[model samples]
Target: MSTHRALRATVVAVAFGATGLLGAGVASAHVTADIYGSEPQKGGSGAIVLRVPNEEADAGTTKVEIDFKPEYALSSVRYKPVPGWTAEVTKTQLPAPVKNGKNLDVTNPVTKIVFTAQPGSGIAKGDAEYQDFEITASTLPSTVDELVLPAIQTYDNGQVVSWDQVSTGGAEPEHPAPTVKLAAASAGGDDHAAMASGSGESGSGGSSGTDDTARWLGGAGLIVGALGLGVGGGAVLRSRKAGKSNA
Candidate 1:
C-alpha cells in the first residue's frame, strides 16, 4: 500500500485504541482527585477539586494529605472548607531553593474536620464518607510540560490510600498521580503538530500514548506528501510553458 494509505490506517488504529482505553476508566483505588477547573500552569490561577471515595468498603475516611511536588514551586495555596472537620495547611522545606524562598510544604490538608454519620451521629464515627475540596493557587511552573500531584487518603483507623502512579503511554494512568496537565504552548495558543498528535505521558507502563504518536505521524506524512505533489505539478507545468515559448 502507498505511504499515504499506511498513514491513514495507523491513525485509525491509534484513535480506536485511545477511545477504548479512555472508556475503560481503569481507576485504581477509592481515594482519588481529579483536576477539574484550572490546569496546572506556572503563575496561572485556577481551581482544583479532590474526589475522595470510601475505598475500605467497611471503614470510612477520616483524614487526607496532599503532597505537593516541590519542582512546581507552588507558594500560595488555599483549601475549601468542609463541615464537621477542621482543615490545616502545612508546608515542608524543599531540598532545592524555590522561586519564593525556603522549603515547600508537601501536604496541604484540606479537611481535618471529622464527619458525624446518620446512624452513628454524635455517638460513633461516620461510615461510607466521601468529600471534595476546591483549591486555588498560583506560581506553578510554566517551563515544564506537565505537573504531577500524588495524594494520600487516610481511614478512621489509620489506613492510608496513596494514588501515586505515572504512565508512559498516552493513556491516563490508573489511579493516576493527580496532574495539572499543561499544553506545550501557552493557553489559547496553537501547539506543534507533534504535541497536538496526542502523545500524552501515561502514569503506567502502557504503550497507549506511543501508539497514538504513530497514528499522528502517519497523518502528518500524508499531508506533507500531498503538499509536495502539488509543488511538483506546478513545477512541471511551468517547464512545459517555457519549452513551448522557446520553440
Candidate 2:
C-alpha cells in the first residue's frame, strides 16, 4: 500500500477503536441493584443497594424514583439516610390482602420509593460519579426468584432517563431495569437474625470493593482513549509531511 493509504487506514482504525471504548464506558454506567452482603433468601428480610451513576456531561443527577411491582407485596420498607438526600416511601392499597412473613394480613403494600437531592447537593455530573442508596425490606416475597425494580433518573437540567425495560429471551434491553436475585428460602433456624447480623458486618466492605473495581475500569478506559488520540494525531502529522515531500 502507498504511504498515504497506510496512514489514512491507521487514522480510521484508531478513531473507530477509541469511539468504541468510550461508548462502552458510557453504556455501562447505568443504575443497578444488588444485595448488600449475603443474598437474601425468599421470605426473609435483607438490605438492597441501588447504585446510581451520573452519566450527563453537563448536568448532575437530582432525583431518583424506583417502583416496586405489586406482586412483591412488601409489608415493610425502610431506607438509610443519605446526608444530602431525602427519601420518601409511598404505599397503595392492594387488590387483595396478602399474608406477610409474620403471617399477618397486609392491606397496603409499599409501591414506590423516591430519593431527592437537597438544595445544592446532587450526584455531580460525571461518568464516574455515583451514589449508593440502600433500602431494607422487612420481608421478601417468596414467589419469585428475582425482583425487578424499574427506576427513573432526573437530571439537574430536566433530562430524565428511565431504566425500565425487561429482558426478553435472555437478551438484555437497551435500558435494562435493575434487579436483585434472591436465594432459596432457608431450611429453618433464625434466618432473619442471621441475615441482619451478617449484612451489618460485611456490607460496607462489599460495597467498597465494587466501587474500587469500577474506578479502576474507568481509569483504564480513559488511558486507552488518550493513547488512541495520540496515535491518530501522530499518523496525521506523518501523512501531512509525506504529502509536502511528494509535492
Candidate 3:
C-alpha cells in the first residue's frame, strides 16, 4: 500500500488500542484538564491546560471555569490570552493559610478561573474543535499527594455541565476531578546538587511542559487518526471498483 495508506492503518490500530484500554466511553468524556507535567515537584511551578470540548451536536462551548481546591494555595497564577475569548480570575480568603514546599505561605487562595467564548468565535461541536486554555501555576502545595480540581463547562444554549467528582481507589467516578500528584523530594543534597549541575531550572521547566503537552494531545490525536483511516478505506474501495470495471 501507499505511504498514506500505511499511515492511516497505523492510526486506526493505535486508536483501537486506546479504546480497549480506556473502554468505549473514553471517546465521550467531558472536558478535562491536562497539566503540562504529570508530577509537579513540591513548591515548584508548572504549565497547565484545561481542554474544553463541546459535546452538543449543534451547540458550541461558550464558557469554561476551573475551581482550585481550597486547601491548596497557589502563590502565583498567570493566564495566557486566547483570541476570541475572555478570562476572569476570582479570589477568596482561605479559611486558613496554606503552605508551600519551601515553607512559604499564602493567605488568599485563587478560587475560580473562568473563560468565556466571544460570540461567533468559539469552538463548535460539529467542527470537532476543542480549546486548551494555558496557565502557569507556582508555589504548589507540598502537603498533599494529589490536587483535585473541579471544572464547569457551559454550552452555547446555556446548558451547564460539571465535572466535580473525586476519584477514589475503587470504581471510577462518573466525573473525576482533574488530579495531579506531587513528586517526592530529592533524597540527598548530593543528588540534588548533581541534578542542579546537569541542567538549569529553565531547561527542566521546558522539558516538563513538552512532556505534558504530549500526554494531553495523545488521546485527541487518536480521533484525527480514526478519521484518516475512514477516508483511506473509502479510497481503497473506490479504486477496487474502478479496476473491476476496466477488467
Candidate 4:
C-alpha cells in the first residue's frame, strides 16, 4: 500500500511540473527579429527577418504592423513576397531633413510596414506556430547602434497584442519590441560593397589561411582521439591479465 501511494504521489508531482513548464513556455514566447547572415555594418544594406508566433489557443493571427521610428530615417525599404499575404509600406514626411547614408538630405522616410493575411492563410492557431516576414533595407542608419521596431499583432478573434515597450537595460519588459543591432562602420567603405568586391587579394589570402588552420586542427583532433582509445584499450587488457593471474 505504501509503495502504491508513493507511486501515485510521484505521478501527480510530474503532472504538475509538466503543466508549469508548458505555461512558462507559452508565456515567454514573443515576436523576434534576426539579421540574415552577418550583421550589417553601419551605413550599409542588410536584410532582417521578423518571426511572429501565434499564441492564442482559439484564434489565428491575421495581421501584423511594424512601426519604424523616425530618428533612424530609413528611406528605402523592400519586403520579400509571402504567399497568401499582402504587404504595404507607408512613408511619412519627416519634421526636418535628415542625412542618409549617401549624405543626402531626406524629407520623407518609410514609417511603417503592414502585412495582412488572406482568408484561411494567416498563422494557424495551436502549437505556437510561427511565420517569418523578411525585409531588406538599402541603407541602414549610420548613427544608431540598434534599431527598435515596435509591432502590433491582430488575431482573427479581434484580439490584439502590442509589443511596444522599450528596454532600458534593466529587467526585460513583458512586451519588448523587436530589435536588430548594427556593426560599426568599416573605415575603408561600406561593408556590403567590400563583400561584393571579394574584399580584394588580402582578404582572399586571409580566408585561405583560416581554412588551412581549420584542416590542421581537425587532423590533430583525430590523432588525439586515436591515442585516447589506445590508452583505454591497454588499461582494459592489463586489468584482464591481473584478474586471470589471480584466478
Candidate 5:
C-alpha cells in the first residue's frame, strides 16, 4: 500500500478499536452511586445519584431497594421523584439525634429507600436508556473513608441481583456495592463557603465536575473512534483511485 493508504488504514483500525472498546464500556457500566460532593462534610448534607441501568437483554427493571447500614449514622434523608417511578423512604430511629451546633437537629432519619417502577416505569431494557434515583443523605458521620450503599436490583422477570459483596482491600468483589470515597470536609476541602452563601448551583457544578470526568472521557473516546473510521475510509478510497489511475 502507498504511504497515504497505510496511514488511512492505521487510523481506521485504531479508531474502530477505540470505538468498540468505548461501546463495550457503556454496555457494562453498572449501577453506581455517583456522589456529587467530592468531599462530603462529616456533618453536612450531600446529594448522591444512584444510576441504575438495565443489563438484561430482554427483561425490564421493575424495582430497586437500597439499604443503608445502621452503622452509617445518617441523620436525614430525602428522595427525589422520578417521573415514572414511585420512591419510598424508610426512616428508623437513630440511637440518638445527630445534633449540629445549637440549633440544627436531625432525628429519626432515613434508613432505607426503595423505588418501584410504576408498570413500565422501570429502566427500559435497551442500548442506553437508564434511570437515576437521586437522594439527599444528610449529616454523614465522620471517621470513615468510604460509604457503601448495598443495593438490590429487580427485573420484570422477577430476577434479583444483589450488589452486596464487600472487600477489605484486595481483589475486587464480583458484585461491588456502590461506594463513594469521602474527603476531609475542611475549610478548603468541603464547599463550606458555597453552602453558607446558598450558592448551591456553583457548588453543585464543582461537585458534579469531578463525578462526570470519567463519563466525559468515555464519551470522548467514542467520538475519536468515529473520526478514525471516517479517516480510514477516505484513505482506502484514495488508495484505490490512485491505483486505478496508474493502471
Candidate 6:
C-alpha cells in the first residue's frame, strides 16, 4: 500500500484500540471492598473482610493501608494473616477528644493497618488481586452508624491508589475516590443508622458494583464502534479516489 494509505490505516487502528482501552479502564477502575459475612450489629462484635484491588498497570501491588473511622471507637481490633504478605496494625491517637458519654472518657482514635505483598505477590500487568483482611472488633458505637474504610493501595513503582472519595446524597465530584461502606444504623438506631443500613445492602450484594462497571465498559465499546466506522469510511474514500484516477 502507498505511504498515505498505510498511515491512514494506522491512525484508524490506534483510534479503535484507544476506544477499547478507555472502556476497559472504566470497567476495572475502582478500589472495591466487601464485608465478609455480615455487618457488625450495633454495640456488638463481628468479623469483616475487606477486598482491595490493585490499580497500577506497570507495577505490582506492594502495600495496602486502611484507616478506620473514629465513630466505631472499637476497643479491640485484629487482623487475619494471609500467605505471602506481612500485616501490621497500629492504633492511632486522636487529635481532639471525642465524647463517648458523660462519664466515659473517649477520643477519636484510628486503626491504621498496612499489608506488604510478598515479592511474587506483585500482580502482573493487566491483572489484579482481591486481598481479604479479616478484622474483629467489639462494642461499636450506636451513633457510629456507618464505618467508612478509606484505603490506599501502593504498587512496587510507588504508585498509590487512594480510595477516599465519599458520596453525599447527590452531585458527585470529578475523579472521586472509591470507598468501602459498613452497614448503616437501623431506622431507630440514629442518623448514622442509615449509613450502616446502606453498607449492609452493599455487603450482601457484590453484583451491584459489577453492574456499574459494565456500563462503563459499554460506553467504551460505543466509542470503539464510532472510531472503527470513521476509519473504514476513510479507507473507502481513498479506494474510490484511486479508481477514479486510474479511469
Best by lDDT: 2
Compute the lDDT of residue 65 as modeled in candidate 5: 94
Error of 3 at 98 (Å): 2.5
lDDT over C-alpha atoms for residue 55 of model 5: 81
Which residue pairs show collisions in model 2?
none
Give the alpha carbon lDDT tens digit for every residue of 95-198 in model 3: 67877666776788677888888888887876477787776666667787776779888888888888898877899888777666666654431111111112
TM-score of each: 0.49, 0.65, 0.64, 0.66, 0.62, 0.54
Model 2 ranges off by over 4 Å: 1-28, 101-104, 189-247
| lDDT computed for candidate 4 | 0.73
**Candidates 3 and 4, the one with greater lDDT:** 4
Which tens-of-lDDT digit does each residue in 1-247 have in candidate 1? 2544565566566556555544342332444545432343444533455666666655666666667655556655555555555455655564546552123343332212222223222112343445665554444555566656677666656666676787688986666676666543355532111111111211222232354466566656665655566566567667877999999
Better of 2 and 5 by TM-score: 2
lDDT of 4 by residue, 132-210 (tens): 8877664678888888899999999999999989899999999999998888888865444222112111221222234
Question: Which residue pairs in model 3 clash with each other?
Answer: 36-212
- In model 4, the runs with Cα more than 4 Å from the true position are 1-28, 191-247
Cα displacement (angstroms), candidate 2, residue 217, comes to 24
Q: Return the TM-score for candidate 2, rounded to 2 decimals.
A: 0.65
**Which is the winner by lDDT between candidate 5 and candidate 6?**
5
Please provide, for model 5 over 146-209, each residue's C-alpha lDDT reduced to its tens digit, 9 standing for 90 to 100: 7889999999888899997887699888888988766666765444212212221223334434
Question: TM-score-based ranking, best first?
Answer: 4, 2, 3, 5, 6, 1
| Model 5 C-alpha lDDT versus the unseen true structure | 0.69
Over 4 Å off in model 3, which ranges? 1-28, 36-38, 187-247
Q: In order, what lDDT does every prediction score? A: 0.50, 0.75, 0.67, 0.73, 0.69, 0.57
> What digit string (tens of lDDT, one per residue) describes model 6 on residues 91-191?
66777665441224456444677777888874454455555555554445556555666778787877777778777858864324544334544544322
Ranking 2 against 6 by lDDT, winner: 2
* Residue 58 shift from truth in candidate 6, angstroms: 1.7
